[model samples]
Each structure stands twice: as C-alpha cells, then as structure tokens.
Target chain A: MSSQPRRRRLEVEQIGDVTVVNFVDRKILDEQNIQIIGDQLFSLVDNDGLRKLLLNFGNVEYLSSAALGKLITLNKKLQAVGGRLVLCNIDPQIYEVFEITRLDKFFNIQKEEQAALQAF
Target chain B: MPLTVADTMNYPRDVQPAVAANVTISSDPAEARRIQEEIERHLQARHVSEHDIFSIKLALEEALVNAIKHGNQMDRTKKVYISYQIFADRFDVQITDDGSGFDPNEVPDPTAFENLERPCGRGLMLMRHYMTEVVFNQRGNGVLMSKVFRRNDNGKK
Candidate 1:
C-alpha cells in the first residue's frame, strides 16, 4: 500500500452480532476509492472477525462495476469464514445494475435495512 | 418549403447539436471523473430525465474504466480520447484508447452459472444494457454508445 494514511470510507455500527456498514462516498465510481473501500470491507472479515454483515446503501447513489466486483470478493471472503453478507437500501437504478449482471441472484438483497437486519 | 413537425421527428438527427465536446486525457482513471462532470453538467442543462442521467453516468463509468484499465493497462503514458454529442432524440459518446484492442465477443457471460462469482467482465454487460446503442470499432480499442431520451417510463427498459 502507498504511504498515504487510510481515510475512513465506511461508517460502521454494531447491532448485536451483526455489523451494519454505510459508505461515506455517494459515488463509488473511482478505482482508488473502490480499492480502499474493498480493503476496508475485507478488514471487517479478516481483522475484526465479524461473521454477519449488513450493508446499507441508502447513502450510496452511484457505484461502478468495480464496486460490484469488490462485493463479490467480499462475499467469497465471508463464505470462506462461514460468515454472511446482506445488502439493503439499494436505489432502483442501482438495483437494475445488479439485475442486468444477474448478481441479484448471487447476493442477499433486501428492500429495507429493517428487512435486511432480519435476514441476519 | 417548410418542414412539418412530423417530418422533423421522422428525419434521423445525424448532426450533433450545438452542445458538443471532446477531451483527451492520460490513462489515469481518476482524470476520467472530470469528463464525467462535463457530461453531467451538459445533460442537466438539457433537462435530461433523471433515469437517463443515471444510465449515462453508470455506462460512462464502465466504458472509461475499460479504456483506461483494460485497454491501456493503467499505463499513464497512453491517452484516452473522449467525445460526446447530444441530439434532440439521444445522447452519444465515443471513447478511443491508444492500446491494441481486444475482441469484445471473447468476453464471457458473467451471468452464466460458472461465472457468477467472477468480479470483472460485468462492465461490458452494464454498458450494453444501459445504452440504447453500443458499437466498437473493428480494432475494438474504440467504442461508440448512445442513449435515447425518454420523458417517462414504467421501467420497461
């Protein structure tokens, strides 16, 4: 990694055993931003040893395919640890992106965070 | 002779509207954001629908990344050329990179059961779905894509 200090890209909150994460950036479009976000997300699994994750996308208005790639990797990481990851509050347009890629089938997506929290 | 409204609508608007722009940048993906901002400002000025804006924005992000990262291999010395034109009926953009192009057909279907876990190759699928038209040059290093304007939609597209 570069010498630059890692800026906080995620707002984390704990509810019982589940960790809820919200992105600090509205547009997860840039590669560097997505990379940092991916590293931070991985730390939740490797470093923190969190089992279940609830990702709230209410604050995220835009994200690129690279971001989706990161999510897929995160999913794999969670599965390797026998953990789970759920996504909620995705915008309709963003939902369409997942649908187009047929990733909606791969990830556990809920319409609302309340519903998502229940999934975990 | 004067043209009627119906005729005006019928005639294919091959010409670029008054608002058109082109820019070239190093293979740096971050620099692509400046071009995205320019397109967003122009689309908002024309009162393009929100759905349409979202489509263009996402597709552009995918295309720019493909050009900078995959096409140019993140080589900052190379250049990526971007240009856009908005007609009454649609918005069009063309991105060309300096690297040798690869055949888009060789790209595997990310939706296929075996490929679902793959992280990359979904960008092309998003570009094809979001834009009304997406065409690549023979060399595959350049791409031309467009989105037709829409007033309202029930999510059919």
Candidate 2:
C-alpha cells in the first residue's frame, strides 16, 4: 500500500535575486515553518547577497507562535546583512498576527506580489 | 466513558482517553500545520467557540512542540500526549511528555524588553493568555490548563 501522502508541505523557489518561499497545503504554521524557513534562509545567506526574501502566504490559513518565532528569527538574520523579508498576499486572519505583534513594522508587507518584488 | 478529575490526574492504563485523541506528528519541522489542525478538530468536537479555538490550539501546539523538540530532545521515539476533561462549567487539558521535567520559572519572559526580539520564549505567554487557568503539576513534566466555558443560552444549566 502506498503510504498516506505527506501531511504538510512547503515550496521554495528562486525568483531573480529573491528567494520566494511559498508555504502551502498547511493550514497552520508552526515549528515546521520555522525550521524550513530557517534552513532556506541559511542556505541562501552566504551564497548570495539576497535582495529580498519574499514570503508568499497565499495558501497558509493559520500562523502560530512557533511559526511567528521563525519569522522573527529570519527577519533578524536577513537584517544583519542588507537583505529584508517581504511578505505578500497574506490572508486576513494570518495578517492579524503580524498586526498584533507589531511585526508589520519590521516586515515589508505588500498587498501584491509585484509590490513585494518591487520593494526589493 | 467520561473522564473524571481523578482520572485526569493519572495516566490511563488500558486505553488512555487522552491517547484516544492523541496525534503523533513528525519532527520534520514541516509537519507543524498538521499538529494545529489535529488540535482544532479535538477542540471543536468539545464545543469550543470559534473565537477561542485558535488560542487554545496555538497554545496547545506550543506546549506540544516544546515537549517534542526541547523537552524530549527531538527524539522521535518519545510521544507527546494530550487529553481533555469536560467539566460542567470548564474544559481542561493535560499535555504530557516522556522527557524529564523542568522548572517553568526558568522559562524567560518573552514580553520582557531585552528579550523582545527573540523568536522563541513566547509559547507559555500565548498559552497563559488563552487559558483561564494554567498549572504546572509538581515535577513539571506536564502542564494542565483550563477555561470555564459559560453557556450563553443558559438553557442547559
């Protein structure tokens, strides 16, 4: 029997000088998001002077503290260098999290992907 | 079939009611979403409100992940158990782990000025904010939290 398909999923891609990570198939972001984002950022950190780390949250429905923690960690890592983390197309519920934590100030959040890419 | 206060105090022997709803997620770090959904389903079945469900789920996920990653040392061999007890006025949850316990006092405050920028350290804060009462049982191996659910309709009571 083919084992049940994997439960959670994440997508990472290189768009121009920016690394666009799309978190998909997962309604919630937790430690999994943290580790994946951390690994992706770390992998791209030294090899490239990343222009922007665009987080496409179009598919993610929920964001937990554990996931938020990773975002904070990623923001700091990118900020240490000249790079910045840009977020776009976040769902309203998920957006509230950024608003509550005041992380919106720390992140360059745009309503559209084009705006995020242009910000870089 | 119903879980009693005394029943909650001790781990189940034959078929632990908590284990009945237990979800074993991966340490792959990518499976965090599954954990949240599982928690939400469990809470919803117990009639938790939509408004409060997210908080309970997030807090529970934080505690569970802490047990899976930090406390259990990310050992996949260990399991994190979550159980629920429905009281007349309140709902309670107990999250237990196989790892050794630690002092909750040592957990750094996430809202503190100096630690504001840190990524972690906010789990317990989120948990406490969502639940009405939070207790760390002696030995600190697990956490028992409860919230009194007031029925707005008032017909059942």
Candidate 3:
C-alpha cells in the first residue's frame, strides 16, 4: 500500500466533538471537485469517527447541482451512522439555490458558524 | 455558418446574433470548463451583476453536465454542441448532445420527502429555478435557457 497522504480540498478542523469544514475560496463546485470533497467529508465520519460536523460555506459563491447532489449524498451517509451535519455562512445568492430546491428544509442551516457549533 | 466569439462582439447589443457559436466538444469535463470560462469572460465584459452571474453560471454548469453526462453518457466518441448569445440585459444558451434522450417529464421531483435523499434530478430542477426561461427540445436531447437581468426601479435595462 502506498503511504502518501491524500490531498484535501476541504479545510477540516476538530472542535471538541464537532468537526468544522471550510470550503475553499472557489467560486464553483462541480463534477471536477465533488468527489474529492465528498471523499474527504466521508473520511471524517468513517475514519475519524467524527459525526457532528459544521460545514462553512463563507468563501463559496456558486454551487452547481452536482455539488448539491454530493452534499445530499454525504448528509444521508452521515445520518445512517447516527451523525449530524450542519452548514453555515452560505452566501445569500447561494442560499437561494438551496431554497429553490427546498433543500434548506432538509439540512440544518445556520447563519453563523458559532450558531452552528452551538446547535450541536 | 456558425457565429464566432468575435462575431458576437461586433453586432450592437440589441442586434446581437441570436445564435452564438455552435461548438462541438468531446465528452470531457475539461471542455465543459473551458466553455464555461469563455461564457464567464463574456458575461464579465458585459458588466453582469455578481448575483446574476452566479445564477447564470450555476444554470449553465447544470446544462453542460446534463448534456455531457446524461446526453452523451460520457462516451468520448460522442460530442456535445453548445450555442449561446449575450446581450446587454439577457444571456441565452442551448446545449445538444448525441445520446438517446430521456423524457424530462419522467424526472422525479428532488424536493419531495421520499426523493430528497436521491442525488440526481436536482440539476434540472436548479436550471428551471435559476433561469428566466428553460425549454427542452421535443426529443429531450437539447435544452435552451435564458436569464434576464433585473432592473432597479430606475427602469434601466
């Protein structure tokens, strides 16, 4: 087995029992990086046993449907393991995408990172 | 003859060609990215608002992905053709692919409780939500989308 560390697209930090993930300052998230982001988030649950997560979207301006799909997939996986995932700091314009798809109701969305961390 | 990017710029904003380049690209994601970047550059030059640009960019990405992934089925031999036009107040795009198309009516509603967990179908939903107009060709192998800029109360176009 090769022992090279995997390159991470998401910045992950551990805060008490919650894992905070900050999306890179990329304008768009689509097929090109969805898998990389997904794998990294999944590992937080599968390998690190970190179930409670806070996803920060402060830097992301646009999110493609594929990226939304990946988020749904990750949310389901985390739920299956009795974990929770919350998102915060979504751009108002980007939040409209969630509202349009009615995904805002499915995911726990907070206006601030502190609120999201406190919600857990 | 297809209109080139240069041709798009020469015509007055009101008389810009309705059909932009009808580009044919292989089923590569990089090609999709290139086309998206070109469209972004064009929109930026036109001074589109950041909010409007984000919406258009997301909608365009969904259309391209649908055409390349579902329409072409990731077959490198297949090609996706995209046509777009830019105006001072509106941007229009259309994408066509070579694969067998599916009925848009049959796509499940992603927002429904039972379907919320599914990862697919959100692309079409998003396109319809973001664009001012969204229309699929009769065969479902093609899509045309447009976004009109929102004017303030000043009545500016």
Instruction: Decide which is better by DockQ, 1 or 3.
Output: 1
lDDT of 3 by residue, B10-75 (tens): 434446643356678998888999998998888778777776778788888888888888899999
Q: Best candidate per TM-score, number?
A: 1
lDDT of 1 by residue, B50-132 (tens): 88999999999999999999999999999999877787778878899998998999998899989887866799999999888
Task: Please name the candidate that would achieve the greatest lDDT relative to the true structure.
Answer: 1
**What range of 10 consecutive residues in model 1 chain A has the weakest lDDT sum?**
A1-10
Better of 1 and 2 by TM-score: 1
| Model 3 lDDT tens row, A2-120 | 25355667898888989899987465565757777777778888888888989999988778877887788888888999999899999888898899889999999999999999988
Q: Give the TM-score of candidate 2.
A: 0.68
In model 1, the Cα lDDT at residue B150 comes to 88
Q: Enumerate the chain B TM-scores of all models.
A: 0.86, 0.69, 0.85
For candidate 2, lDDT tens digit of each residue in A11-98?
A: 7788888788787644554554455555655656656666578989898776677677767777778888877888999987567666
Better of 1 and 3 by TM-score: 1
Q: Please list all clashing residue pairs in model 2, or write none if there are none.
A: A32-B29
TM-scores for all candidates?
A: 0.92, 0.68, 0.89
